[model samples]
Target chain A: MTGDTHYDLEILAELAEGLLDDATARRVREHLAVCDPCGESLADLAAVREMLAAVPVPAMPLGVAMRIDRALADEPNPFASVPVGANGLSKLSLVPALDASAEVDSEELATVTPIRRGRRVWVATLGMAAAAAGVFGASVLASSLMSAPGGTLAEPPATSVSTPERSPQRTLAYTVRASGHNYTSRELSGPLVGYFGPEPGTGSNNDEQLDACVQDKANELDRPPIAVDRAQYNGSEATVMAFWEDQSLDKVRVVVVDDNCRELRQDGLATWN
Target chain B: MTPPPEQPATPEHSAVAGARASVTDADLLARHIGGDPQAFSEIVKRHRDRMWAVALRTLGDPDEAADAVQDAFMSAYRKADSFRGDAAVTTWLHRIVVNACLDRMRRKSVRPVADDELIEAAERDTQLPDQTAEREVSMEVTAALKLLPSDQRAALVLVDMMGYSVEDAASVLGVPAGTVKSRCARGRAKLAPILSHLRNRTDLTRVSSAKGAELRDG
Candidate 1:
């Protein structure tokens, strides 16, 4: 067997798929006639392709069609609706519907409100402390701001709080906790509460008001969040909520704040931790 | 604007006639753009099944696939004016759906759930009793496909399963033809071992032994 002249797998795969040019295919065919191993390999690849092609095409689900109809009905001419500025560029405000499409239901949003209100207070307090502490506090404040909504926070929230737990040298003065796990930081409180229900210490009246607001917002939007939880972002903790449709996690919303509840950052569709 | 009042023919008859007519997809798109609302609906009715199939195989999660298809069609509706007419409407739609699936896959990778959860979800979707064996094999293939990198899996799905030509698959993938070819080859090479058990040919042992020897030598 002329095993010395074995073609690359890519070439053989292309030959099997009839993707190669005529000359190259002819050459591969000639080689395959003498090369038993190569021939078998080609046959195996061909079988794999056959099996893949045979994978059944499922019928379109009824829900998808209905959703599409509803969406189209709501926006008959999406292109025409795009507002144009003086420069002729489209001035598209962030559509709430687009955001709603990512979430599960109104209950998640309801859970997120109290947590957000609490975080805002803490962030405001932290912002003042950071301001008084000068550059170091400024850096923390900047990080805090970045973690807020509409701020350009790309990295996961876990990075800020997770490091102290993983690395011994970076001991934090304050305690940082999430999903029941605790880590200590010397600079601030370790407890980062991402509450789904009423905020602790808040009265039932306040809870009722928050729930009303959530319901109103939900009524306005077609889609709402599936679940909401508290998560720590950067050094600040926020109410982290997720919108899931069907079984997939569609979007995450983070309401980040500093320890003083002064520095507020609210973001929708943030990456899930 | 409303469509003109129809004659006393049945709806099914009209739909069948519509299907038989030589109205191109582009024609339907143009009609929709020109305010014929039913044109886009017709397009959706014709292609929704195939689009679902592509999304399902690519995503391996029925719920996610449905969401992806919804997103794709909505995007298509909104961006219909952006259609350049260089490719068939089906190809353009497939590209959008594939992209949506990839985006979901990327997000899922960033925050992966448990394997048990995934298997359970797949089982819930394929709960029919008559096709249990077929469903099992499909699930196995899907699980194996998930093990491959996203790009390789996309390439394999487009070319191998969906039967797109190499050039067309490359176009949809926005990669060079050579890259698509390599991705397919590498993807198949990985899948061969995983799927070998499904092959019942008499020459299986011989082929595997030859593959082993080749691996040892090379």
Candidate 2:
């Protein structure tokens, strides 16, 4: 029984996270239906989450941004040397070199531009010094390699320290699966209502048909439909809670299907308030 | 010269264009690549305050939130070229800010503070004039938010607090929309109970509905 209690927590966390497959989520839901302790734990954790959300964020300090601007001023563009991936970290290559001592002078811009455009500006004049440094550094590295008696000349150049070329950014796709002992709450009716984009007015509201589609998807995954408990029907939104086979935050997708059913929302866990 | 016949624009046409013009995070990013550092600044200005609020709410420390917001904007700028315009700018920015806060949390190894402790502290901090009551209400609600785990807190902040749709929030968090829906529901359910309790407390009750109207009118 003790072990089973622990097992229930494991199931609840997975269910809450929406990471479980359809069949697994279903089994957990069935268990939750019969298990009072597990159900209570889930609710308690959920309440805790809600309370934590009310915390306030303070106003941003003026100094941090000034520092960032200063850092950018002296930081040579990382793109000048390294490449980046669409989905990987880029632009940040120059960030590590951001020393607090770097001055944010307008003069640095005038000096730095000449090197890229090959103008005979003071900054370009300093390029000779940098080029010399590069040559000297390369020679030192080459000498160290050559001094190794068994070093292979045919070895490929070390590109490990260099950044890669830029590529298009990749969009992540997420899947949602829900299952639980069916409870009736008004908040759980209709299609899954989800928000999309930066602006609030741009998101979509699901009609009853969309709810049917969501239920159909759930059934297709072998999980029972989310049953409605009560509905406080407002003009556009109906607030209700439902008995899901499992209750996880991550097991839903909210999209604005165009007339052609083209999805317009980023794929991920949809929030409903 | 006669004006061209004024085309009657249908709502559908307007909707499509509106959606298109709403600029994705990737679009802003592409503009940054064209040597307009200001484009990056635009993105920063657009989401910086919201990102800061997210950090402050999750961490409950203004100084930590400041560092988090700066780091998030810098991270987004560095990774601007990687953006593909797949999600809204706000959502992507939220993800960056949340991730930065989480990273800070990991480094500091912090946990959520007790509810009563935070409530007591929040009560002490509620000192604004009655005329500015709405702002105080918002601040009060914000205090309870500090008790949630970072992930759920981020979800609730985007949904209930900021009023983002579940789908848009999912896009911002880079998760399935269904997951956002569940979290929003769970978050609201949890918040409703505590808020109901706070609604009865004397300090919070001081800001009446009439005061709320007065603040709005002012």
Best by TM-score: 1
The native-contact fractions of the candidates, in order shown, are 0.29, 0.08
lDDT of 2 by residue, B19-45 (tens): 434664466567677654445654554
Question: Which candidate leads the pack in DockQ?
Answer: 1
Interface Cα RMSD, each model: 13.7, 17.0
Query: What interface RMSD, in Å and to 1 decimal, does model 1 have?
Result: 13.7
Chain B TM-score (each prediction, in order): 0.77, 0.65
Docking class of 1: incorrect
Model 1 segments beyond 4 Å from truth? A1-39, A79-273, B1-22, B110-132, B201-218
What is the Cα-based lDDT of residue B112 in candidate 2? 57
Candidate 2, residues A1-273: lDDT per residue as tens digits? 332653344345446656568987676666666666665555544433333333333323222333344335334343333445465445433223222222223243224332222111211222112122122122222222222212233121122122221212211111111111111122122223211101101112224554454344344443322222111121112222222222343233322223232333332333321
- Kindly report, for each predicted structure in the order presented, the TM-score of its chain A compared with the true chain A: 0.27, 0.25
